[model samples]
Every structure is written in C-alpha cells, then in structure tokens.
Target: MITVVGTGTGAPLPPDAEAAVAGAALVVGARRHLAAVRLPEGAERIVLGPLAPALDAIARYFDKADGTEETDGQQETYEEKETDGQRGGRVVVLASGDPGFFGIVRALAERFGSRRLDVRPGVSSVATAFARVGLPWDDAVVVSAHGRDLRTAVHVCRSRPKVAVLTGPGSGPAELGAALAHRSGARVLVVASALGDPAHERVERVTPGEAAARDWGTAVSVVLCLDESRVLAPVRTVAGPAAGPDRWALDEAEFAHRDSMISKFEVRALALARLGPRLGDLVWDVGAGSGSVAVECARFGAAVTAIEKTPDGCDRIRANAAAHGVEVRVVHGAAPTVLSDLEDPDAVFIGGGGRELPAIVTVCARRARRAVVVAMAALDRVPAVRDALDAAGFACDGVLLQSSRLAPLPGNVTRLAATNPVFLLWGVRPPARTEGVPQ
Candidate 1:
C-alpha cells in the first residue's frame, strides 16, 4: 500500500505518519519535507519538481512492489523484504497540510488508486490561516489560485464577504491585491505568511493598495479578503459559499429606478438567463439605468460593476445594491469610454447606451469571457449591435420580447396591458472557449 502523509504548517507529523515515512522504500516529497524527516537507511528519494516525473518514479516502485516482477536493479524483492522482518516495499508521498485539501493528494490518489493509499492528513494552510486570524472558516469561501487564473480569486474576493485564497506563484497576494485594489478598496486583506512557523509566521491586515505595493515572497500561505462588517455571519448549516438568491428577475418595484427606465421584468428575465452570473464570475451592466440588472447579477453571487454616465444613476445603483443586500461596484461614467479601466467581465449586460450601443457592444463583446446580453428598444440599433457581436466572433442569437401585464381596470376586471417591445440579444463565445479563459 502507498502511504501519504500530510505535514508542514507548523504541526509535527504524527507518530504513525512518521513511522510510515521511515518505512517507505521509495519516499517522495519536496526538499523541505525530506530535510525535516529521518529516512530509513538507503531509502530511494525523489525530490518533487515536475509532477509527471515524480508520478512516473512512483509508478516504477508500484509496478515492482507486488514482488511478482524483479526489483528496479535492487537485490531483494518486496516478498524478500517482508520476509526479512521489514514492511513490504511501498511508496510514501509527502505533501503539505491536508494534501487532500487542494494539495498533492489528488494527484497521488488519481495515479495510485485510493484503495492503495493510507492517507494521514494534517491541518490545511487554509485552516491555519483562519485560525491565525481567529475566525470561524465554515462561512468563508476558499479558492485556490495556485496554477490557475488569478481572476477567479479576485472575483471571489469581490463577490463574497469572506474569502480565503491559496496563494501560488504569479497568483499570489501581490497579484491578487493589484487586481482588487482599484475595484474593491473597501475590502481588507489579511495576509498570512509562513503559517505554523513560530519565528516566521505572520498575519497582517492590509488594504488592497498596501498589499499591491509590496513584494511578498513565496512564503505566503493564504490571503483572507473580508468585508469586515459582514464577515461575522449567522451560523451556516450548509458549508462553502452562501446559496444563490432563491428568487431572481425581481419585480421592478423592488429596485429604485428613474421614471421606469430600468430594464423591464421580461427583458431582465431573458437578459439574466443569457448572462449566467454566478460566484467567481465578473459581470458588467453597462448603461445601467438604475442598475437593476447589476443588482440582480450581484444577488446571484457574481461580482458586478455598473457603468453609468450619470452620477445619480451611480448613486441609484449603489442604493439598489445596498437595498438588495448585495455589492455592486458603481462606476459613474459613460460606457465605451469608461469600460477600459474596469477588468474584463465573464458576462456583460448592455441595457441602454443610445448611439454608443454599437461601440459599447463591440468593446464588451471582445472582452467578455463567456457571454454578452444586450437589451434595447430601438429596432435600428439591433443590426449594428448584432454586427459588433458578430465581429467579436460570438455565436449571436436573439428574440423580440413583448409581454403584457395584468392591469386592473374597473370592477375587478383585468386587461392585458402590453409593455413596450424589447430586443434581447445574446452572444455566446463557443463552449470550447467559454470556460473563463481569456481569448
């Protein structure tokens, strides 16, 4: 059987796990793990560099471990080793705390079946960081930026009130801070570095700007981004992120819009369907009349930025966001010009851009990672917007949405009051490229 021991993070390895490492015929770990352990005399060691190489090395031992085949140039086979009063030759993979928790355990388990693995888990760095900060982590959203795009971490930080980001090279705290600095200044970042080490461990709280200004070395364990006011939430019965809003396409009366200028409920329903906003996604609502679309997107757990040329509209967006108990970054500037400063969105909703509709769609479509949904009144602008989306190489589809509401006339009689017709157009980047990777 292959034994996997989780170490590092300041905790001493358990006696059983240590003994497993000592008995390992072929030991595999990083430099630090190897240095910390006391290996049995003349045990084969593989210092991890590239993952495939290490897995290949481990496979060699497993192939011969059954004692059915000759050893890899070794004098004795596993049967002989076991008969000589030693445990049958087996592999031990050392990894950081809770290797199963977004660590090396997955690779090991995938390569060598779980049935073959005797896993001993240590406290994960995420747990250590949260413990250092003295907060309950059951409510925190944890994401790994290691070997993945930093944008996912950034968006999680933007959307959630609490988040723990596992830092990796190029996707570390500095990179995360720079991405969040301009957009989410209200958040406080708790930078936890070298956790579990008494001499070098640090848990410092800094603003996104302060974090961006520094060069944090490779010791970072995790970064906690929090909106302090909402960090302490009610006890969570269900773990991971909070659930998405139970209801969407909220009533128009729910939002504070300017003289019924918001995207009507019917238009919003289809627009939201096209924009598939969810956690870890960045969504833009350009020309957000009252940020109805933006607020709705935020309710679904997507990080939203509402761009409006009017200051009052910006305030309304913020107010609407606050009223809905969601966060929406409100940028008070016209689209097609102001969108340059904001980060690329996973999805975008164009509500009202007037003559700038085509230009706005063109800009948003090019940068949107997944889809772009546009809602318009003028029939003339639909062709231009479609052209722009087509130019951006999106698979464009649309519908003319016309709905009627129940109107109370006289004596409890009902009439179908036809709302103004709206053109709802959506452009989806083909599924092959829709997985949030920028083109």
Candidate 2:
C-alpha cells in the first residue's frame, strides 16, 4: 500500500494526512518532498531525487516481496503486469501541493493503480502562488515545465495575458524570459521560487532579461502579466474571435508569398472548414510558405503555430504575423522532424510538404484535433496522404482547387489566366460517442 501526501512546501499538512504519513512504513518522494514532512523515526525512507534510480529501487522491493522477475526502469509496467489482488507493501509517495494538479501524483498513479494508492493532497503550489498575488485561479491556465514541454508555457504567455508556469531548473524563469523577449513589450513577470522553504524568495515585476539572469531557487512558478504596449487592444472579457475582420476568407493576393505560393482563398475556405479554427483553439500552418492560413486563424482568435523550412520563409512568416498584428508563433525547421516538440494542435494545415507529405500528414492526423494537407504537384501522393489520414482515424475527404483571374490584354481587354491546379485533402476527428453510454 502506497500513501501519497502533498506537503505543500511551506504550508503544513492537514491533520488527517499527517496522521496517514506517520503510520506508513515506506515513504518515497523527492528530497524536498521528504524534508517537508515529519516522518516516524524508523520508517524506511526512499529519497526520490532521480526518478529512474528511485523507480528501480521500488521495482526491486516489489520483486523481492512477490518472488517475481526483477525489472529496473520499467517499474510501472512490471507492477501492473505482476501484481495480483494482494497488497504489496506499505509505501508513501510525497509531492508538493495537490498531487493531482500536474504533480508527481500522475507519475505514481501511472505506476501504481489508483485503487491501491491513497492520496492525501495538500494545497497546490499553483494555488499558493496565485493566492499570494490575490488572483482568482478559476480561469488561470496551469502548466508545468518540469520534465515536459516548455512550448506550452511559452505559447500560453504569448496568447493569453495571464498564465502560471510551474518552473524547474531548465524550464525556469530564464527560459520563459527568453521566449518572452521575442516580443518587445514589457511584461510584469513574477517569480515565486521556494515558496514554503527557509530560502523562499519572490521576485516581482522583473523584466524578461532580468528574470532570465536571476538564479531562481528550487520549485519556482512564474506569473506573467503581459503589459500590452505591443498588444493594440486588451483581451476582451468575452472569449472568441473579435468581430473586426469583414470577411471569413480573403482573396488570394491577401498575403505576400513567392509568386502564387500562397494557398488560394477558395482552397483556404475549405481548409478552414476542416480546420474549424475558433477562439481557444490551437492551429498549425505546417510548411507555412507565407503564413497565410496561420495568420487567418489568428485573426479568428485561434492560437496559431506556423512551421516553415527555409530561413527566408521563416522570416516571411514572422513578418506576416507582425504585419497582421496577431500573435502567431513561428517555428523554423522542416516538417515532421521540426514538429517533434510542439504542443498538440487543434488543427494542422500542410501547404508545402512534398514526398514527406504522407509522413507529415500521418503524424499530424494522429496528434491534431483535425488536419488538412494541400499539394499542387505529385498527384500520386494524394492517395497516400488520404490513406494515412484514414488510417489515423480521421474522416478523410478531398477537393481539387482550380482558379482563373481576368487580366488586361495588349488592347486593354480582360483575358482569363488559369492558375495551377491544387489538391486539398482534409479530415476531422470523430467526437467521442455519448449517445448510449451512461455518464
């Protein structure tokens, strides 16, 4: 039996939870987590500083007890596959704050069954940080940069005026500062580090560069209040796209690209249909030659991620984002590989992928909330891309886009100039079935 307790750092554990830990035989947690608690004198204490090593020790303990084969780094899988209905042993895992809120409790729960484990949660560090600043957390977005993606932290700050990022050594205030530095506006960055410890420190209203330079103590959470000198308008209390852009889809010449490289407005209209871009949604403009789709999505208040391969193309996307006066995060690199560490997107629109289109389509279709891929050449690739999306559980569909524009002839008479044919392939994720299932 493993009992997980949240010490909540500076805050003391609740009466009932403290009693639970005092009665436990084996306790597992980080050094800080361990220090926060008052353990019984003879309980076998396991310091969980390095995750792999600590999990190995747990695996060994369980192996010896059950007379089963020993596994090291695969403790969670081993426990799940081997454990019968019997109680293994008395163990306690401690974390900071409410373990359920993006805390160590997830790791523990993934390793051990929730039924066999007892969780005694304390006040979440995120809650404590917000409380210290006298801010309500109901609408706050809580993200952890602890052994996970920092892009979420960066993107949240980019799109939202207020965000709370749980920071770690590499993903601390410095990293956030660096991401924020891309924008020129001043931000009121509050770093709350070591909240409950003796060396607790809180740095308020520091500039991005200064926050980057400071040596923030352990277990830091950053509250960034964007001072919107750069933002033309304040975020409206009501969520969703601001009603300003007169049209949903604009003309083909709306964006600057290399001689007809932009996705045609007609095609973009259908792509948007598949994309379903809306407020609070995150969209990706993969192979974003001119960032046209991404810019449009951002216009509708959907957070956009524009991925481009060429250096010149990346520069164009950035310029386009700034020109449109919307926050569209631009990532520079080739598709599929460059897409490695990005946040899961609500929708993805591929515009320039060639043979790599299928693989790119496959990856995005599997991960994104919806996807659309467009290609001008390589007619053979369409079947493969459609097949990939279908295999990845998307409801696959496509359309061929052909457009003609009237131009003045030698006599000043208008003549139709045919544009190159382009194929638009799209898909959407089927919503979960709630029709017959009891809640």
Candidate 3:
C-alpha cells in the first residue's frame, strides 16, 4: 500500500506514521521532509526534485512487488532487486501539511488510483498561518500560487477582505506586495515562513509597499493578505465571502459623474445581471466614464479594472470606488491599446467605446472567459457590436432600457422624469460540450 503522510508544521510524527516510515522499503519526499524523518536502514531514499523520475521509480517498485508484468521496459533499469529475506516492499510518500490539499497525493492518485492511496492529513499551512495571526479563517479565501499564475492570487487580495496565499519560489510575499502596491485600500500582509521549524520560523506583518521592497528568501510557506479595516466581519450563518450585495443597480446619484455620463441604474442592473461578477472573477470596464459599472461590479466581489483615457475620469472612477468601499483598479489609458497589457478577464463591461466599440468588443470577447456586457447610448453602434460578438463565437442578446424616475415637482407632488434610452448588449460564451454528455 502507498501511504501518503502529512507532517504538520514542525511537529512530531504520529505513532502510525512513525511506524509506517520505519517499515517503508522506499521513502519519497522533499529534502526537508526526508531530513526530518528517520527512514528504515534498508529503504531507498528518493529526494523529490523533478517528480516524474521519482514517480516512475515508485510505480516500478510497487508493480514489481505486486507481481505485475512490465509491458514497457522504461522502469526496468531503476527497479530495486528484492533481498532474500524481504517479502513485499511498502512505499511511503511524505508531504507537508495535508497531502490531499494542493499536495503530491493528487499526482500520485492520478498516476495510480485513489484506492491505492491511504492519506494521513495534518494541519494545512493556511490553518497554521491564521492561528499565528490570531484570526478566524472561516471567512478567508485560500489560493495557491504554486505551479500556477500569481495573477489570480493578486486579484483575490484586491477583492476579498481576507486571503491566505500559498507561496512558491517566484510568487511569494514580495511579488504579491508589488502587485498591490498601487492598489487602493489598506492591506496587511502577514508573511509566515518556515512554519513548524522554530529556528527558521518567522511571521512578519508588512504593508504592500514594504513587502514589495524586500527580498524574502525561498523559505516562505504562505502569505496572509488581509484588508485590516474589514478583517472581522459581522456574525453570519454563512462563511467565506458574503452572498453578494443586498441591493444592486445603485442610483446614479450615488456616483460622482460629469454631466450625467454614468449609466442609469436601470441599465446598470441589467448589465450587472449579464456580467455575473463573483469571487475569483476579473472584470474589465472599458471606457469607464464615471466608473459606476466598475464600482458596482467590485461590490459583487469581482476584481475590476476601469480603463479610461481622461485623467479626470480615472480620478472620478477611483473616487467612486472608494466612496462605495470597494476596490476598482483605475487604468488611465484608452482601450484596445491599454487592454493588451491587462490580464484576461472572466467578464467585460463596455460603457463608452466611441469609434473603437467594435475593436474593444473584439478584444474583450476574445479574452473574456464567460460573458461581455455593453452599454451604449447610440442605436447606430448596436449592429456592429452584435456582429463583433458573433464573430468571436459569443451568443449575443440585447435590450433597450428606458426608465422614468419619480421627481419632486414645484407643488407638493411627484412627476415621472424620463431618462435617455440605452441599448444593453450582452454575449454569453457557450459551455464546452463533454463527449458523452447529453445536449
């Protein structure tokens, strides 16, 4: 049997794990984990560097002992010969914290099978980090930057109030801090390094600017990024991020806009519905006039980027976002040009694209993973935007919104005031079809 063991942050191994390690004929783990455990004298030790070779060795060892015929001769050279006294060899795979949580057991299970793995989970780094900080983690979002892009982790830090980032070599506290240095809101980055190893263990709290300036060597286990202002949330039945905002489609008066340039509340509500912004989603607001849409999207827990050409518009967007207590990245540049540099988004909202509506729609629809919502005052640009979405393989749908709000008259009475009409165009990417799934 292949036993997957989790070594908790610098703690003694359990009796069962100790027994397993002592009896293991082949022990495989990282250099640190290998050095920590006492392996059987006769067992072959494999220090994990490039995992493919070690996995191949493990498969060969297990297959040979199980009396399985080797069809491929690849593993024959590395196969360990059994001694006269030994019967069947036992394999032990050591992992940090929980092997099942973004750990090596997944690779092992995929190569072998779940039935073969006997997982012994220990405390996760996220749990340990939160414990070190004296904070409750039930409301926190946990993301791993190990062998993956750091952009998602960065975005989570921007949107979520509390997040635990599992750091890798290149994507540690410094990288994360650098990304958030220019972002709005006050954040406290708790860098927890070398957990469980007292000599190497250190937990330091730093600002985004401070974190960006320093080079924290390769010992960092995890970084807890938190908006210190909103760390403790109100008691709730649900955990993690709250279930979106209570009310969306906020009034136009709520935002700071120039000459009523913002999209009306009626139009914004429909656009938000189509955009479907949520946690872990990145949204782009191209030609953000007053950033009303961007602010609203951010309120829904989506990381938003508002791109506007005018300096005043950019400032207004930032102001509006700050006023609403949400984070919206204001990019002071024109679309189609600045759009290239930004990360690909899950959704895109086009507020004012001018002559470049088609080009902006093309770029957004091309990069957007889910949907694109566009708000336009001119009816002439509707066909072109719809055509652009269609060309990019998006199923297009649109509606013209015209609303009348109640206004106080000179007398002690109210009158219906009609707002300018806007066409709300949205395109949803069709879900990928599975081979055996029914239509």
- Report the number of the highest-TM-score candidate: 1
* Whole-model alpha-carbon lDDT for candidate 2: 0.73
lDDT of candidate 1?
0.88
Q: Residue 405's C-alpha lDDT in candidate 1?
A: 96
TM-score of each model, in listed order: 0.94, 0.59, 0.80
> CA RMSD for every model?
3.3, 10.7, 4.9
lDDT of 1 at 21: 78
In order of TM-score, best first, we have 1, 3, 2
Off by over 4 Å in 2: 62-89, 184-186, 217-265, 273-292, 299-399, 402-439
**For model 1, how does the per-residue alpha-carbon lDDT over 345-396 read when each residue is reduced to its tens digit?**
9999998889889999999999999999998899999999999999999999
* TM-score: model 2 vs. ground truth: 0.59
Candidate 3: lDDT over CA atoms?
0.88
* Per-prediction tally of clashes: 0, 2, 2
Cα lDDT, all candidates: 0.88, 0.73, 0.88
Clashing pairs in 1: none
lDDT tens digits, residue span 1-439, model 2: 6677887557777787887777766788877677767887777788878876776677666665555663465433334322224355456788877888887666666776667678888888777776777665555556667777676666556665556787776888877887667543346677786666666556476778887777766556555445445323454564322464568667756677887788877777888777877655678899999998998888776778899988898888888777877778788888899887887887888887887988898888888865655554568888888898889888877778888978889976899998778888888777777988864
